[model samples]
Target: MKAVGFHEHGPLDNYDLLDVPTPEVGDGEVLVDVKASALNYMDLFAVRELDNYVPQYPFWGGGDVAGVVTECGDDVTAWAEGDRVVAVPFLSCGDCRFCVRGQEMLCEDFTMMGEMRRGGHAEYVAMPEENLIPIPDDADFVTAAAVPVAGGTAWRALVPRAKVQSTEDVLIVGATGGVGTYAVQICKNVLNVDTLYATTSSQEKAEFLRDLGADHVIDYTEERFDEAIWKLTDKQGVDVCYNNVGGDTWVQSMRTLRWGGRLVTSGATVGPNPETEIRQIFMRQLDIVGSSGANSYELAELYDYVWSGDVEPVIDDTFPIEEYMTAFERMDNRGLYGKIVLTQE
Candidate 1:
């Protein structure tokens, strides 16, 4: 199998396209012939080994996978050969307390695929049967590959974790990124927010966000988005803020919310430590909630929405395995409006 990986974590230049041994299915596992895979910002962190997250030597990381089952291991009765599926990124011990309660993302022994072991960046991958979800027959590999992490995370943050109401006003920070695009769609089309606002870097990106259902777009590069939101809402502020970017944006996102409003976060690509405004938080009775990946039930809901066309994955570009470097570069530069997919041709 031709795999894209790094021998030791260092930098993007360390990644190489190597001919590696194909993974074999184990007991209760399934061997998937990877048709398409999608990249996330975590892939960049995994490659650099940030925050002491060390992968096994010769590591490959790709979170979202859409493929076909080529073989099933012993005791894997739920799936068989020739089944089309999407692999859930988070893997949990099914016996854990959180998993038993259907909160698998909070399991004590939870870990994500592509972070701890070989991932779908290769031609084939062997994952536990429990990690596979049968996608709709009409779903294409590229679209299915885009949902597991990006769409699932957004769904978890906005729908279940935040419990956003249709009458509420919402703001999506970094609204043109992978998770942000889905956040906009869910807020506008599914959750049906009263008003949807999003922040991006450029006018072009702002326009892209508008098309994704943002009622208002603010170019953060030009002005402070919190002030923009305040002005737009006539100083009432939004009822909910979906904030994934951390650092300075954390304080800003909180400031954009109205009294009793909630802020939910999943990713922290833009530096985690932020000088929080405790005075404003207490005075306004704000709620700050941290979320991670979605559980099996949440992923099922997201898949159904996608299959019904109520939600769609935005693809910025697609590349073959050989051009993986270009795909990484595009994501690293923040030049894309949606997910970047890689095919295993």
Candidate 2:
């Protein structure tokens, strides 16, 4: 099997294409012929072994995959060969307390597919049958690959954790990236939020966010986003703040929230820091909620929206499987609007 992976931690240039043995199916597993895979910032972080996190040598790196099942282990009954499928990226121990309560994202043994184990960056992958979700026959593999991680994650963070309601004002930070783009659309279209504020670093992205349903777009490079958000909301502050960016933005996000409002966070791409103000928390009585990746049920609901054309996956670029370096370059340069796909061909 042909695959792209890295043997040592460094940069995207360290990745290489090579011939590796195909993974074998285990009991309750399904073997998929990977057609497409999507890239995320986590992929780059894993490759560099940043934050003392180390992936196995020659590590395969892709979590979101859409492919056709070629084989299924004996114990698997939910799906069979030749079925098209998308999968939930998180792998958790079923017996854990969190798993039993349907909060698998909180499991002590929780690990992402591409981060902690072999992922779908190759021609084939053998995953637990429980992770597989069938994709409609008409769905494009590239688009399907784009959904599992980013789209599903946005759905869980904004819709469920934040509990965004109709006619409420919402502010989304980093509104042009994969998760941010999904957040902007879902809040505007699905939740029917009255006013949507989004932040972007560039004028083009600000315009793009407006097209995606943001009622107000702030160019952070040109002005302070918190001040702009306050002005947009008439000094009352937004009802909810969807923040994935960390560092300074995290602290500002709390300030942007109205009294008794919620701040939902998924990832901190800007790196972590201790910047939260205790005064704001106690004075405003704000809710600080943390969210991770989505579960199978959330993935199913997100897929339904995708299938119905209510939400669309944004594809920045597509690279052949062997061109992992190029894909990572695009990701590192922040030159993409959404996902960078690697096609198995």
Candidate 3:
């Protein structure tokens, strides 16, 4: 099987496309013939972060996969050969307290598929039967692949974690990427927010966000979005602020939220250790909620949204599986307005 992986953690250059041994399907697992895989910021992060990601050397990292089941394990009964599926790539010990309560993302033993082991940036992947979600038979693999991590993150952040109300006004910082675009869609199309605001680096991306249902688009390159949002709201902040770009934007993101409004986040792609203004959180009586991968139930919900056309994955581009390195390079530049998918030829 052809896969992309790194034998050691270092630069993006370390990621090599090679023909490695195909993964074996153990009991309770299924081997998927990966039709498509979506790239996320975490895929690139795992390439550089040496401390707390990946279980071993020669690790491959891709969390979003959509494909057909080619083989099933002896203990697997829920899925079989030729089942069309999308993977819930984050894994947790099912016996844990959190897992039993359906809060698997909070399990102490929680680990991501790509981060913990080899992932779907390959021709084939073997995952536990329980980790797969069934998509509609007609669902295209590229779009389904785009939904798992990016769409799932946005859904988990906005719907379950934040519990955003329909009438609320929203500001989504860095709303051009996969999660951002989905957040915009959910805020507008699903939640029906009174006002939906988003930030991007350029007017082109701002227009793209507008088409995705953002009511107001702020070009961060030309203006400070926090100030712009405050002015737009007439000095009153928004009811909610969703931020995944965590750097200097942390302070501004908090400022854009109304008193007692929530600030939800799933990632800090900008930089994790952000300079803080604790006062914005405490003095303002703001609620800061953190979210991670989509739980199985949430992924299922996202599939329904995509299947029903209530929301759609924003696919920026597609590349052949052999061009994984090229896709990673494009992602590293942060030039895309949505996800870049890798498809099997």
Per-residue CA lDDT of model 3 for 1-345, tens digit only, reads: 888888877899998997789999999999999999999888888888844767776788889999999999898999979999999988888888888988999998987878777799998999989899987877899989998888889999999999999889999999988889889888888889999999999988888888888889999899999999889999999998999989999988988988898999889998899988898888999999999888888888878878999998889899998888899999999998789999996
What digit string (tens of lDDT, one per residue) describes model 1 on residues 12-117? 9988998889997899999999999999998898888543555466778888998999999999999989999999888899888887888888889888887866
The local distance difference test score of each candidate is 0.89, 0.87, 0.89
List candidate 3 stretches off by more than 4 Å: none
Sorting all predicted structures by lDDT, with the top scorer first, yields 1, 3, 2
lDDT of 3 at 269: 91
- Clashing pairs in model 1? none
Off by over 4 Å in 1: none
Error of 3 at 181 (Å): 0.9
Instruction: Give one digit per residue, the lDDT tens place, for model 2 in 1-345.
Output: 977787888767778886899999999999999999999888888877653544456787789988999999988999988999987888889889989988888898888888888788889999999998988878889999999889988999987788899979999999889999899879977888988999999988888888888988999889988888788778999999999878788888888989999989898887767478988988999999888899888888888888998888888899998778888888899867988999986
Off by over 4 Å in 2: 50-55
Q: Tell me each candidate's TM-score.
A: 0.97, 0.97, 0.98
Pairs with steric clashes in candidate 3: none
